[model samples]
Target: MSFFSRMPLFVLLIGVAGLAMLVPAAYAAATAWYEIARSFLFSSVLMLVLTALLGAATAGGRRPGPHGRSVLATMLGVLGVLPIALGLPLAMVLPDTGIFNAWWEMVSCLTTTGASLYAADMLAPPIHLWRALVGWLGGLFILVSAVAVLSPMKVGGFEILSSPYGRSERFRPLPESADPRNQPQFFLGLGADRTTPSARAMRVLRDVGPYYAGLTLALWVILLLAGDPGLVALCRALGTLSTSGISPVAGSVGVHSGVLGEVVVAFFMIFALTRRFWPGGGELRATETLRTDPELRLGLTVVVLVALVLFLRHFFTSFEQEIAASNVATGVLISLRNAAVAAWGGFFNALSFLTTTGWNSVDWQGARSWSGLESPGLLLAGLAIMGGGVATTAGGVKLLRVYALARQSERELERVVHPTSVSGGGRMARRLRSEGAYLAFIFFMLFALSIAVTVLLVSIRPIEFDTAVILSVSALTNTGPLAGTIHLTPSFESTAGFASNPWEGWSGLAALPKTVLAGAMIVGRLETLAILALVTPDFWRR
Candidate 1:
């Protein structure tokens, strides 16, 4: 147990991923699918053997200390190299997907992008479970890394709230009497302690893993009661908690759980909007609570305003036409029902996209029918770009950054009206309005630049501009399902057919573009700043 626990992060992850295959193996065995079962069993054994060899060689070395760079590199490996290792069984089982496609699919799920090359009916139930399980593990990895690694390093979105990068208290020089190499490190951050990186990571998993798994299990049971089949419910629950948006079926359109299921899922989506939902994620200020969280406020505001616009866009037009075509009371009742449906759809869909989960409300079709408009694909993309709260499963620019930018903009406007006005929100508020805002703006701009660069790369495939844009945004936001919702503009021939879906579009792409999108997903998951930090010479010299 000690040797296993002391294994390097990548080795540990590889082993866990190997063990994860047993789930599908067991399922396949129970269902009399021995070929598939053998494939998984063989892969699991191979991975464990590899893990044991690697762990034995490296476990006794100078124990990994609190080196942020190591953690960052492990994360990159988890997103990139680990997927290649994890994809073997998948490639064996899904013969149509070559090793490269299998690797790409695992990359998508591990980064919580949840993009698939196969149609829903193409893979068996066990395969879908594999994808969802991988995604769930990926989500847990993000959470643990966010608090244990990124917070101390002052990278990720924590830069907005932390002292400037490389200047954090955690990075201070060691005392003269103490040999830095011999002493344990103690840094102030969420879940920080006097321990090695691997120990710290395991501690966080122990603390946070249950809540993560329990939430998924609870949601799964509730979804089953709501009418979804067992496997379907389990996948949905895993997808929801992980914000992976993966499923055995299609989007909510493919769900049998109906409006009630959608409602329940939507309620659970709130977890992505704020880190406060988790242990050790509460506000630094005793006075602040979830109700007062700026991220939550900004997220709710965005959802409500976007939903309202979506509802109103077709409400008046559809209402007037219906009233003119029908008798008075009948027209009023029907129009009211349509309005209600549209509102609910807008609200649900808006929340889904904002969290980067990419769930299309089942009533989204009804909303479109009532509003007399195609799905607002561009608008959904915009919401995804806004993303969810910091240190959560969802990805994008993040709500805290957005909130900071908004607060700073408001302050700037006030300054414009009164030259001598002082920002008066207290120390934390002042920090947020000043340094926080500046950092947030920088990240937002970097995020935008990432999208532009990704778009350029994808466009090189000779893909249409609209499709490239959607693909870029989806990949960079870690919101893969967003690519499937491209019905907003009619100009592209890609969206012309009823059978069109993201899988078809993505699968047809040349290898280069697909690889580029995969890289973008890694960038989105790790955030551009962390990647940049890795390349800087000073990071390695230390």
Candidate 2:
């Protein structure tokens, strides 16, 4: 343990990732997939040995405390460089796919993007298990970093709590290595002691890791009981908990567990909507506050609104079609039942995409069929952009930022109507309305800029404008499955194009495009501000 304390976070993460390979290796061995088993075993052993040597060499050095910038760099390394090592076994298993493809796949999984170059049926079950496992670990990594690293840095949604005017003496503007002045008050208020960031991370891991694993285990068991195969249950369970949307059978749409499984998954998806569902999440808030948390309320609102729009849109259209084909009374009853199903489908899909998990509801196709309308692909793209709560597995601009912007808009509108009126919702609300909203607005603009730049870089190839937009948003939002689901082109019959779809999936893309998307995934996971920090001269000089 002391030896490990001296090694950097990146080295430790690599060692853990290597140890994770053992799970797949053991499964492959049990299933008699000997060659695949051998690949994993060899990779695991190689990584562990290298990490051990590195740790020993660092044992005499000063312990690496979790400073904000160093943690950010470590995270970047985990998402970027760790994949090269993690993908070794993947490359060995899929020899035909080049090392770059394997690296891209691992990056997608490690970033919890859930994008895959290989189709659902292309990889062996063990390979899929490895992908899901990597994503699950990635989810844990982000959760820990959000609490320990970003909270102190005030870069993640915690920026909302920063001094509205400037850096309050209470909260420093910049984080420094081992600076006692830079403690994260928001998280520190949650029962965590004023300690180094690394200690806080370890404590968070100890508190949250078991529940995270247990939730995944519990979900996996329930899915199996719901009639899914073991492998499918395990993968979906990991995907759901991680918000990765990874699946052995493509996605939730392909699962055999049916509506029962979707319902169960939906219950667990609430975890992603707000961190309060987990330990250490209710920072500085009263017990009753969880019920009225802004993030939770905003997330639910988005899901319900999106669901209602789709339901109504499809219901009216389906009722008209049914009436033309049947008697009025019969059409009314049939449309009611169809509307119920469509509502459920819309609700489930809306929540899933809102969390940025990218899971398609099983009944989504039925809903589309009832309406005889093209899938509302753009609506999903929008939901993914809204994303889930701060410090959760889901990724996007985040719900808190959106909530802050909304609050600011309301305050602005009130001032417009009555130029001399005092606005109040308590100090927290006031902060959110003022500087929090200011920061949120800046982030929103930066996020949009990232999308435009990514789209521009992607379009340097032969991709169409709409296709480029979808792909860019998908990557930047860390919602990889979006690329395949959204089709901007409409057929002559007013349905999504099947015959002449312009966008090919990830595997069909050129090397340059894939590389650009991979970079976008890392940028999105790290968020823009931290990435900017990496390039700043002051960050290096410090």
Candidate 3:
């Protein structure tokens, strides 16, 4: 602990990331991926040596501070440096690839962005697992940072949500005689009067880290039992937990897991949609439990409502277009079946997008598939816009803030209806409803501005306007697969009632345009608010 705590903060984190990569490296060795194993092993050694050098140099240097700026800087440093280190192996393996492209691939994985520069078939199983593993670890890092570092700073998603609570999670006290800057709270970011920064971080890791690993392991085992291949099952478990929605195989999970497999993935994806499932850092309250959880309620409601609407719409349309059916009974039965499939498709896809996992349903055969009509792409996009819970692995604008906004609007409507009607739930509740809504709205607008800016920038490189828009949204949502271009322009397929995003396979995009989307992915993961807070004059003043 003393040795690690002496290390420069970024160096310590980089060392940890390097160590984590060894898991995949060992796996590569076992699978006869000698080159891959050598690459990772060498990277890990280099990182550790760097850690030693930094630790010795920083031994007499200033310690980490409580200021959110430092925390943000550390985070940005990790996001930038770790990807390059992780991509070292990839850059060596992939022919004709520059360091920038390889780093982009690692950035996508570590950010849980799930955008692929190479098709699954092009990569070995070990390499695919490495990507999934990177995403899974990234999710864990975000979770720990959210609870330990960012939450105290009242940045990350913490700014828009609850106020910081009293009483820090326990740890050993730093010596009273220690430098003021080396106070325990300086590292943890809160008033935790415990051990050194390394010890405090490890304490949090010890308590919460196992749950993440356990959940992924349990799901991985289940998926394997459910008939997915070993590598695929492992990737699926990691992807679902991370909400990266990455698949080891070229085809979707449905292709490998079947209906039963998709069901399992869906069940597990609920964890990403609500923080109630993950062990809570805050005090346990009734509302935070699954029974009364707002995220769960709204998510389920959206899933059910959207599914029903899609099902009924398809049912009626199918029934009306029953020209091929010779018998009335046959026509009715086919319509019923089609509606059932459509409903499930709608439900599965909606929840997936809402959680920002971005998994397409097995039945998403597009507009020209088994049924002549298209599955609704715009509806899926809207759900993606709504996002998942604030603290969870999922990304987007978040449902909690959306619910707050909706409640605020409803309260306003009620006041209009009866001018003297008192709002319920006390003053705190009222404030949360109104102030929370305003912040959420600001975040949304900022998000919109970011999208506009990103699209404009990308379009300057000769990218189509609509493609820029979709790609920007997809990147901002941390739903990389969503950025896969959907055909919107007039074409033969459009004339024949079919559309697909040719850019879905990201490798085909021009290097300059790809860079634009990659930048968006980084900004999205850090989020609109964090970026603003990091750069704000007021924040710096503090």
Q: Give the number of the best model, judged by TM-score.
A: 1
Residues 1-542 of candidate 2: C-alpha lDDT, one tens digit per residue = 44444567777787898899999999999999999999999999999999988878777877665445676677778889999999999888877776787898899999999877766665788998999999999999988877766665556666666543333323234455555766554323422234544566677788889999999999999999999999989999999999998988854544598899999999899999888877664432312567798888889988999999999999988888899999999999999999998999999999999998988888899999889999888999999999998889999999988988998999889999999999988777887888778878888988998999999997887777887788889988889888767764321221111221223356666777778999999989888857555533334442
The 10-residue segment of model 3 with minimum total lDDT is: 491-500
Screening candidate 3 with a backbone cut-off below 3 angstroms (N, C-alpha, C), the clashing residue pairs are 172-194, 172-195, 367-374, 484-504, 485-501, 486-501
Candidate 3 lDDT over residue span 218-331, tens digit each: 999988888888988999999999998888776556786687888888998888767666654442111534776767888889988987877776666667676465578887
Q: For all the candidates, what are their Cα RMSDs to the real structure?
A: 5.2, 6.0, 6.5
The per-residue C-alpha lDDT of model 2 at residue 108 equals 94
Give all candidates' CA lDDT scores.
0.81, 0.81, 0.72
Off by over 4 Å in 2: 65-67, 164-198, 281-288, 488-504, 531-542
Clashing pairs in 2: none
lDDT of 2 at 289: 67
